[model samples]
Target chain A: MMSDNSDIDKYYDVVVVGAGPAGIGVGILLQKLGINHIILEKTSIGESFRKWPIETRFISPSFTGNFFKMPDLNAITPDTSPAFTLLTEHPTGEDYVEYLENLAKYYDLPIKTEVCVDTVQKKADSFVLTTNKGEYKSTYVIWAAGEYQYPKTNAFEGTHLCTHYSEVDSFSDLEGDEHIVIGAYESGFDAMVSLIRARKVVTLLDDGDYLNLVKSDSSYSLAPFTRDRIEYVADLFDYYTETKVTSVEFVNDTYLVKTANGQTFTSPQKPINCTGFASSLTLVKESFEFKNDYPLLNDFDESTKTSNLFLVGPQVKHKNALFCFIYKYRQRFAIVAEKIAKRMKVPSQAIEKAIQGYKDNNFYLTDLSCCDDECTC
Target chain B: MMSDNSDIDKYYDVVVVGAGPAGIGVGILLQKLGINHIILEKTSIGESFRKWPIETRFISPSFTGNFFKMPDLNAITPDTSPAFTLLTEHPTGEDYVEYLENLAKYYDLPIKTEVCVDTVQKKADSFVLTTNKGEYKSTYVIWAAGEYQYPKTNAFEGTHLCTHYSEVDSFSDLEGDEHIVIGAYESGFDAMVSLIRARKVVTLLDDGDYLNLVKSDSSYSLAPFTRDRIEYVADLFDYYTETKVTSVEFVNDTYLVKTANGQTFTSPQKPINCTGFASSLTLVKESFEFKNDYPLLNDFDESTKTSNLFLVGPQVKHKNALFCFIYKYRQRFAIVAEKIAKRMKVPSQAIEKAIQGYKDNNFYLTDLSCCDDECTC
Candidate 1:
């Protein structure tokens, strides 16, 4: 059910921001717990996913292993699989948006589209969410606003002069025969591959030796899907590892890229910046304490400084564990819901029954001790 | 340890046949339970995986989700991942062999190579396994000899006039510009894709409309990985759906393929047969009851006709469950080991402690009701 500004309810037990995988994931749990909550989407469901570059796809392959309790890697919930719904392994942005829309409809999630929450202020008893639609009062706030829509555009001196990887509609449609791409991460490689398939020559400037770096954690290393794609086009592109771009300068219809190691490369077109994304926490930074740019939260994922404010999604971090992927962040949904429900004094049996499936399928992870181990094989 | 013919053990508590994924998976669990067992192999460890055609790769993608309890799809054990060890999503035959070899070495599994078990006869309270090297006696036997090495060459009339898909060293090395691929499942599509990549023309004959058949279970339909690969070369092949090949005949130095639809196709070289494989159960058909070509087993996957005899790996089946993939069959490893361990009177505390990790990671699936549900989203 979608609500407009005129029909907006002033109070809700909990107000969830964003309607991407994270918000929808936790919202479903709250609904199952019989909590009075509403998910507020700034535009529509999966807007960030809908905005991905036309040629870009999920690096993690999706398989319908839900029956075996492994579920699809990109599925936001235990029972639903993106691969089974979309019938594709690497879903494109549009395809994923369709999946998100289907989940939102099938679960009958209460989401108010076009309701952008501008500021969240906590009063003595509750949190007040000031949105474009109307003011909403809630006992708790869950910050699930994802980070992809907000790209880190000011990473370098003249980064603004180059096209942000997120801004490009499609790499193949770019007007260039030869291109220079800065920040050789997943996004950078995706752009390179798309361009190469378009028969364009590319010079990729990698900030680090990520292509050769292998980590047990998928959050820190290249996905095997990306590595497989690179094998076919490895000979078509020029990759420079350990090369950090210092700045970009434009002079007389030509763009110059300078690196820290004292190398200059010239291109006739704007370089694509694939550095990274800034957390949406910037929107509500004051609500929680911070350490090293990440919000500090309690074991329940609630804001330490705020009484009832909770956090979920990719921005979640604990020590060295980075819960940036759907598979990682989805585990914390039940934890947050259980804590909030207990505080609300919901029936213990009901809470247990609601979370039983999550626990059975390894979705409710309370122990972080095993997260640091490397694969011995 | 690789045992030679001269040092063959004459008796054991449990004797596992065939050192493939199923053999290795069950062996590790038995070792953890402190059971006296030895895995016997006719040739070498991972011999079936090593014999896969050079162009064939695992259709299922591998990812290291061990921390989240969604271990790699191709991993036989919860603690190991093929993707993490080999750094590839879709491991080739040789790459998978390396992973299996690593597991065999890491677990120190007791395996004797070059010992062919030609026959098995049930005696009082024991079973005698007649092998090429010598005679062996055991209280129990686990059949893990996989199906890839046993091609179903007699599926259709005059099949000997065609080359089995497994016999090809490399699809690219075939000596023909035009080829007829006589099966349109995974192997058929795989052959067509490889031939198309090699710049050869292919005519694919599918027994059913498998290309359009979408089943909730992967065992009945094409995988998403194969679907994605087909997108690139969908227009490059001649696909005939609902066409069942009746026979392959040689006429005037040319191969003629006759189909059920009264259509005949001709090629200079022999047609490639990808009709699939016969179960290794054929090796011990008399020892077990058969229903629909699958062995009948009790709740513990033990033979219904023979006492203390168990089954593991792809050959194990329930009402509608097909344990054909590593991820599916690996779940039963603990089940089989636990039954044997309990019969052996291993302490209850030790049994529980040894199988706890498997139970925690979903390596033990005793319920089948949830397996039939389809993805709603």
Candidate 2:
């Protein structure tokens, strides 16, 4: 029943890193399971969502579908919906932060904010987490630090010369008449729409024709929200599809955006990189194996190399099913919690009840193969 | 696999009236269940959706939540997502109509457009549907003719003097300097937002403080989307809470709106009524027994008074659960299909397979009690 870190023992049963949806989801379950765990947050809960561009909103819409076994698309837990809490469908960053804060308060989850985890080292039977606040010891560690903080700096050369889309507070604040935006994903299109709305001329460079692609998975396709926004501002921007940006260079107060097609564009503003994000697993790179720059996890989301160590959040991938969306990854919260609980020998009846609840609510998914089918209708 | 009514049999297992989500959904199941049935549309598939105000969008957010048993909120079927098909989170009426058209084509569900049902009478266990196009004989009938076409005109006196919100094709087209909007629900808020955006001075009268009311059920409260829109335009409108308009009188040029609170408001533009819609069930009132204005139905959604006649769509309420949203009413599609398929004596194996498919996807809800609980989080 306790969520606040009070009257605590020196050692904890588990320590979940990051207080975003993934960590909060795991922390909520662990608390419900009567497992003593402390959530270590580097900044605050939903900090990633808070850092989203000023005009940024969740492409996934939120509805109070909880009673119908469909947890709100953006909700981390089963009983909550950001739409109901924030009164918004596509919640802005601040709105989402409010939802996360409310969830944390409701569950009384033990989250220690402004406590940065510097490193994790396995010592004997327990893992030691050295944070800026203090050292923490736990039997199991759930790494849910997420990928927003770690932009893909190494994805392209001279990435530092350009501003990452995440760095821009608001497109309206950009001090330029003409801007050259590199990348055509959601963020890229978002930047385009906002800039156009603010009356700024933009040259949007796309690596691929992402606008026309309609893949079964939303991860591969531009979200419907983004598509609708693009449609509203498409005529206002100079779009170059099937063109990839290789690098950017500053020359005489202008960014020279070079592309894979051997073309270059000059912009008064630094070229924005909407390329994507790098896995925060670099924090514990040597501990687990990586494939395609992502952590390799077993069916239970447990690290392939590190036993009792679990991974959650947007970076999670099994073959092709990107557990990036809340609805997709929320399923694993129960599975991972069950695995950790079983390892700790938590009561069988409690485990069954909790897991069954998750299963009955459609919040538990064990199979990944079924996630590949396209909509027949 | 055929959709057009050209090759239809002289007698059908069931005849579904309306080609919107409800009827199209049931028709898809009937086609899959191997039952000979056809969907009759007064105009075309999703015509009501197409007829919605140009500024209107679905309050529900659409996500491809099918794998987790939560299909897109606006999807007619389990596998489809309006967000994925139309590429928009809150699709406009036109966008939704396109989605319905695509689904009908994909499923090849027999749908005859412009075939308006003038009268439906049951005779000796067979329902004879007399439409403008022709007469059809069916063993069972499903009335999916939604409520959009039947706006509640009798709720207030002098309603015809005021423009029902549904009558306005687009708020931008309204030629007005000042306007008085009646009702403060989703449509009222929507009209206010659109008119405000178009630079009109609006006076929105609310019978209650509906803006502050946050009910767990979306039916009672203003939609999250509407809330977000109101947040952006709240300052633009002159809001009058606890004001119920008893009547509207056009005195010469201006509209003098009379309220129960004894406050009168003058607007150059006619007041827009957002009081809500009347159930289309009154068209066949002699058949189904009514409870609190809604049709009383069995678990199967078949009429309590009329045998072999089914009811689907927003009007099909069971206790407190208003099956108004596609997600709610869609559950009964399989149940009704199974019941009719059983009576038609389609093999038990076929019925079981189809019904089990619905159950597995979380689309079949026989129990309404589970939907009453609010999210504790």
Candidate 3:
């Protein structure tokens, strides 16, 4: 439900920024709790998902096993499955956006689109969010502006000479016969595969041997979907491990890519940078204390420095656990909503009933100890 | 560990037949409960998995989210993941065998391969299983022999003229370029896709419109993985829905497949029948009362007519819930084990502690009500 700037309330018990999976997820919880809340999206629901490269598919496969208490990995809520809705295992960016939009409509979540929150400031008792449309105040603020839109473009010297992976509308539309892809992670391999499939030769430079490094956690390792895609095209690409790209130099319509290993490669077109994304937390850096570039979060995911100000989405980190993926970060949605609702003096029984489904499924993860264990087999 | 036939005990509390996922899964639970039991297999471990067609991959995808309480869908045990062990999402039959072998070795399960149970006769208080090696007696008999190896060859008239879907070693190795595949379920679609990819012309005769039928339960519908595989090859072949094959006839070195709709398709080679399989429960049909060809069982999946006789694996059905997939039936492992362990008077705490991980990780599903809800979006 899109509300006009004038129609939106000036104040709410909770205000969620961004209409991505994290924002929509937590907003559903708050709505269920009967808490006054609004989700403000800079663009529209699932804007980041809609902006994904055309060839890019979700590395994590989706399956409808929600009835067995195992929700689809890509589902925002336990009751919905992307696979069932989209009828595809690896939903495209557009397909996922449809899922998010469906959720927003089904839940009748109060959302205001095209309202960009430029800055957030804490007053004596409330958070004042200054948006492009107008000012809004909330007792609790959930910063769910995800990381995908904020690409890490300034990673190396002369990085602007290259195209970031996120900016590509489609790999097949690239004007070059050959391309040099920097950073050999999920996005890197994805770009390389798409290029190769488009009948182009590609070179991949990796800072680490991600292909050989297998971790028990899907969060740390290359997903099986990526591995499967790369397996068929492994012989078609030039892959250099431990060769971190230093910079790209454009000379005479040629791009010379230099690496940390003192090796240089030439490409006719601008090299593609797949060095990953910067956290959206950069926007609200002053609200939370920093530890190793991650915002400090308490047990309830509230900011350590600012009271009632919370962090959701991929930026949420507790110890070694990186809540980056939808499955990982989604677990914290209820915890954030519950804390805000409880503090608002919502009835205890109502809160319990509202969050019971999340608790029953793996959505509400409070115990961080289980996140670090390696698979025995 | 493989036990010698000479060292096998003549008497036990439980004797689990077949060393596939069902038997092995239940055996682990029984061992954890400190119950005296032995799992007997006619062949080596994962014999059914080993027998799958060379090009066939698991319809259900596997991901290692075990730490977050979501175990791999194909994993028999809660702690183990096929994706982690095999490092693939849709593991081939051979790859899956490796995972099953690893689980068997890791748990040090009491497995006696090459010992086929010929006859299971109830002898007053105990059930006597007469095997190829010798006679063994047990208070409880868990018939976990899966249905894959048991192909339904007599589904139609003159079906012997055609090759059953289970009999094909590889679709690429088939004798002719043109083939007729009967029954358009998972196996039928798999055969068609593999043959088409191998540069063959194929015609499919489906008994029902499975492609158009969408069910909330994965067991009742084609999996997303199957849908993805067929998406690329959908236009390459002729798919005849609501066309049931009635008979196959051999005439002048050519085979003719007759359908119920008065359609006759000709092929140089024998037609492929993928009508599906009869339950392995056929072996001990007299022990259990039958309803709609499914063995009638109580809440514990025990044969209603017989005492101390239980059922496990894909053959298990409760109302509309068809527990045919590994993820579906594995939930009953703990329930069956707990009941048998309790009857043997094992300590409640030990059983509880042993099955705690299963309960927490969705390995134990006692509530069947959740199995029927449809996805909202």
Candidate 4:
């Protein structure tokens, strides 16, 4: 480890790294209590959501997406639509990005959008953060940098033929003669559908059978107009049409995927990879001592390694269950935000109010403006 | 009111009415335990669903629709798609009906469809259900007959100008005319959209300004495809778009509508209405004393007005919240079915297994065949 030039002169009430769900969530709680805090992000806010495929909508409804301490959407506006209506209409990735942006603007959260923290070393009573911009010294530090930042590629024979899930954002980008998407996760299935829609000959490889873990009230298959053009060769041939791609090799400038059944499928459409993302915690590894490579958090919110340092979002899932997707992110964010605010000695009412508004079970949809025929705006 | 028919002798394990969500849910549960029961429906199974307009789909997703005491969907078949996938694919009224049918067949529940009960009279120890088919006796009656059966037409002058939601199943039946949909409830909005899509001038009426609910995850406005065809003129523009029909008096050659707003609008198309629906429980009022003209039940499973009689489906919503809808019915049915099965002393490991599965939060999607690729049976 390099010698640390840690700054102990300035101390913040709290320092949160990564302006994604967890960081912003804590920032929201602190702002609600009128507490001074700083949020450092390596990129723009909700960069992961921004990178999501255009057609990718939230798997769960908006009822689970509210931030704590805000007014219940229904209480705010009970006329236009209800929680159920809004939830049924799946919000796309762009919609979420817009929602997060609006939320950040609404709270006027204290955030440093482009600051990348390089190290986080704990002093006697505080954490010292060394960033590309400068040093951020705080009494409490929350390492909320999410887990999807790192792209994990296995040492396969043709590893270069695949791309990360983050790279493929739209169907139009999937243009080639034939393509093979690796991984059997939701991302892989999503990519398969997208590639098929783009009219690309596609082969999906998986070590395990892909499962579609969706829930509904009834069995209705609602296909969008965009999806109407795509056709699955095996419609309703069980949940997922099972197939196996064993290996990928180049044949006549085209990638040929060999299946375990001795079937060779050729695809020229630049083989896009849909494998899931991994945690990018290497940057602060030297500074922060992790328990079994984890932030040492207890339950969902408490960070054991550092007193003030907390972890939320997909990063926390690294230590426990992989529950960092959009549906689970907001709910978990609210929990961590409340815990962090309480630990910082913020007023209980403010945090409580935020939690009340943001907690699960209750959902609302509110229109910002009261529109009358006389006044269009 | 006629004299009480307490002298009748009718005994059954349970008599469930209205073959909608609640009725079918309970029926499936009873079937799992080999309980001898009869599910009574005045119309077809899921009759209200069948009556729904072609464009209507469930607001809730499918994952929440499973009845208790059933195998987790994953345990049954991994090929089964989650409720959301099916619902999002082609959301239509018939799609849900088909799912219900599949579930009913899978369980082979004892259900007598199209047996409308005219009255239910409590006897000394059981209940007698006088239906169009025949008089049946039961120890318990669950009222699952849902709301939307009785049309609650507003007592407005020239009421003939409006139509109930149930009758307006298709826009093709609507003739040429500038139409005004009366309420802003779900049905009212649905009608307005349908009329507007049919290229008719449409106006929505609300006592208060319509509340702006939360936006859908996909878009901020109404469902994208549905919103595109319809034009929503808010009440503020009432002066500009008020082609009101004061009196729907018809002449020999054509029908004329006199507008109260000093504008007479006449179209070759008859004005359509979408006020709302009342519960179909009115038929049993003479037979049983009701509180608030609604049966006071132990939370929604109208399994007994007396004994051996159950009212399931939309009618239950009349007495309570409209929970007989797909998402909540299965849960309610599980309770009633378990009680009845226990009363009948049916030997059932399936019910016990299902309860455990539910307690574990293991959803139906997880109930799949263990066989991956080789297990064909």
| Candidate maximizing DockQ | 3
Cα lDDT tens digits, model 4, A187-251, are 66666666666666666666554343222211111222213222343351112235555566777
| Candidates arranged by TM-score, highest first | 3, 1, 2, 4
CAPRI-style docking class of model 3 based on DockQ? high
DockQ of each: 0.71, 0.59, 0.80, 0.08
Give the lDDT of residue B33 in candidate 4. 62
Deviation of model 1 at B154, angstroms:
4.2
Residue-by-residue lDDT tens digits, candidate 1, B37-154: 8899989999987888898899999988877667889988778889999989999999999998999999999989988889988899998898987888899998888888888887
Compared with the true structure, what per-residue lDDT tens digits does model 3 show for residues B194-303?
99999999999998999989877898899999998899898999999989888999999889888899989999999999999978887899899988998988899899
Off by over 4 Å in 3: none
TM-score of chain B of each: 0.98, 0.96, 0.98, 0.70
Lowest summed lDDT window (length 10), candidate 2 chain A: A1-10
Which candidate do you rate higher for DockQ, 1 or 2? 1
Better of 3 and 4 by DockQ: 3
**Residue-wise lDDT of candidate 2 within A229-305, one digit each (tens)?**
88888688999998888878888988888888899899878888888777888888877999987789999998899
Q: Tell me the tens digit of each residue's lDDT in model 3 across A34-149.
A: 99888889998899988888999998889999888888999989899999998999999999999999999999999999999899999999999988888889888999999999
Candidate 1 lDDT? 0.89
Assign candidate 4 its CAPRI class: incorrect
TM for every model, in the order presented, reads: 0.96, 0.94, 0.98, 0.66
Interface C-alpha RMSD after superposing true interface residues, each candidate, one decimal: 1.1, 1.6, 0.9, 21.2
Q: Note each model's CA RMSD in angstroms.
A: 1.9, 2.6, 1.5, 11.5
Task: Give lDDT tens digits, candidate 1, residues A46-156.
Answer: 999899989889988889887767788898778888888888998999999999889888889999898889999999988888887678999999999999999897778
